[model samples]
Target: MLGATSHIAGRVLPAVGRVPGNVVEAVASRPGRVAAAGEVARRFGARVHDGYDALLGDPEVDAVYVALPNSEHVTWALRALEAGKHVLVEKPMALSEQDCLRIGRAAGDLVVMEAYMYRFHPQQRKVVQLLGRGEEGCGEAEGRGEGEGGGIGELRVVRAAFAYPTPVEGNIRFDPALGGGATWDVGCYAFDVPLWAFGVEPCRVWARFHGDPVDLGAVAVLDFGDGRSAVLDYSLEYGPRAHYELQGTRGSISVRNAWTTPHEDGVITVVTLDGVREEVVPAADAYELQVAAFADAVRGRRESLVVPLDHSVRVARVGEALIRANAVGDWVDLTSR
Candidate 1:
């Protein structure tokens, strides 16, 4: 994996050990950080490479996990694919839709997947199942007898937000040239989770931005077809908070701490026609699950959880539209893309 010193990388290493067939083969980062790389290697008992190219050249490295900054995702992912390695890139896969498509096209025979780890969570599956049933007890009490629980087609409002204060002053997330911002950093989840749950793309988008250079906060609205809509709010200046709410005709589901909740013991609240039910979901290590899933896909054992590079491309397009809308203070139509 790239960016061995990142927070996500730290969490992922132990999880990699839990996967049945996985091994921590190597760690890579920029040169002049031998000490840092060595520390990671010592912890995981993996070899340390000073340069990414050196790590990529290793014939034994079958696949790569990229946890680099937002801008570098496409470049390094494309490079890994060119080197004949399966790739699992972190979220916001690319800065733009065009880049997502370009990287997808370059993958050739290798599997290229984006790492939205929460998708594999059992809580997410439960939410999907609960929504599939017709009931109304969570959000609106009067709608218990709604038709067919409104179906997946009846999804209406999706609200998602993720934010945390950035303590590192010179982190890549604070650099504009590196595609840094609250929207790209955490808002990608806000944008992607709804898309994943609803299985549809937005036809229109609008946004408002706060702060300068690296935006401190943003509020965006996405309009899907059939009167369905999603709202995404994100900020980097706030305390740690993450939540996702999905509303349907029958009921609604709410996920608290969706992004970085603990793996071993996590709970997601599901409200249905009966009442507010708290589902105790035993969390498997998400990083392990992600790596195992990617490995299975690489070995042709299973299909990816997030399918088609076009999905990431569409996410980028929607994010770009939000940026545009924020700049002009007007709604942006993304039907063309």
Candidate 2:
């Protein structure tokens, strides 16, 4: 792994233990304050490299997991792919479509995947199934309904938020030059899930931002074709909380603690035209599922579930336009990019 010190690496490295044909061979990068990276490597009987090059140079390391900052994803990912190592990069694959395309081009015949762990959770799969069925109460009711008014309603308003208090001064997330911003951070997930669920590219986008140095918060509207739309909000100033709400004409479905550290038990509540139904989804180790899926892709056993490179690139394009729109206080047309 390239960024052994990140919060994600800490969770995912151990999860890779459960999947077969995988081993934590090395931890790379400059040492971190937590020392957890060293501890993790020691626990796994893996060697710790003082630098990323050492890990990449190792003849036995077959693949790399990149949990670096947003700005570095493209560079490190491309380097890893050029080194002939498969890559599983953290989300917001790059800050722009051009960078994503460059990284994708570099991957040629190797695996290069963006890491969106929740997509692998069983609850997420169930939600997809429920949406596909579009029938009330036929499945676990997290939230399912048809609006009393009539037209067959697909997902209408999607509300997603991810926030956590950050006191760490000089963290990468606060550095604008490093692509640190609420949009690049949590908003990527907010935009990605709905885009994937709706299975359509957005036709229009409007956004607003708050805070300085780095945007402390943002709200955006994505217009998918067919009158379907998504609304997203994100911040770093709020108390720890993450949730997603998908509303349809018949009813609405929501997941509580949709995204959180130490990933909590996911809850789905469905409201239908007839009544309200709720289901408590059991806690799952999503990190393990993410790692297992990555390993499966590495083994050529299956395709990846995270948004593909092209899709992620398009998402980044939308994000870039959102940033521009937020600055000018005008809706930005993204058709060209």
Candidate 3:
């Protein structure tokens, strides 16, 4: 693991522990925080490195889980790839599409995945199945047809919101240079679900931001063309909430706890001409499932990655456009780019 971030130590590491054959192996951080890294490493009985480079050079380490700040993702991921280590970097892989592409190019034949653990949850897979598509790697091979919105009868629009109160005093989410903002932090999740549901890249987008140095909240719309779109709102200054509702021609699906799935289970409500039905998805550690997928990819046992780099590039492209849209206070054209 890298950076020893709270989310990594508190959530991701525990999930990794739950997965068979996977191990923490090692932990690293900046010199100033090496002691903290060691503290985290001790919990897993793993070795500690003084800095990222030291961990990257560790011969026994076969892969890395990068939980570093957004700005550092590309640099460290590139370094790790060059060291012949498979990488599982956090979401919003890079701040720019170019950087994401650069990583993709450099990662030739290497197992590199963005850590979007939420997608690994069975609830999301259920959503994908309902949409008449397969979750990232679970497709025809899993006997699920790859038709479009078969269950929902043509997905037309997606409404998503993810927000939570974040402290401004010392939180990285408030630091502009660190790639901080509500959009980069939470809106990315909103951006992803629609893209995943639609199974296509957006053609246009518009956004309006609300903070001075960094966006504490923002509202945006993504146009996928052909009468399909996504309306998204995210914030860093609100009561905790995360969910998305998929609207279709014949039916609609609403998922509560869409992003985190913090409880023992998640619920999905579907409404159609027939009637409204509720689905209860038993809780499972998405992070563990993600780790298992990564391990499979590393061993060359899986032909498809859970979160491919190209998807991250698309997310970065939309993110860049959103920031630009905020700067100019108008819709951003994604087609030309």
> lDDT per prediction?
0.77, 0.75, 0.82
How does residue 72 of candidate 2 score in lDDT? 88
- TM-score of candidate 1 relative to the true fold: 0.90
TM-score-best of 1 and 2: 1
Error of 3 at 323 (Å): 0.8
**Model 3: worst 10 consecutive residues (lDDT sum):** 137-146
Q: Report the lDDT tens digits of candidate 3 across residue range 198-260.
A: 767778889999996888999999998888899999999995878899888888889888655
Per-model TM against the reference: 0.90, 0.89, 0.94
**Candidate 3 overall lDDT versus native:** 0.82
Counted clashes in each candidate structure: 4, 11, 0
The superposed Cα distance between candidate 2 and the true structure at residue 201, in angstroms, equals: 1.9
Candidate 3 residue runs with Cα over 4 Å from true position: 134-150, 261-263
Q: Ranking under lDDT, best-scoring first?
A: 3, 1, 2
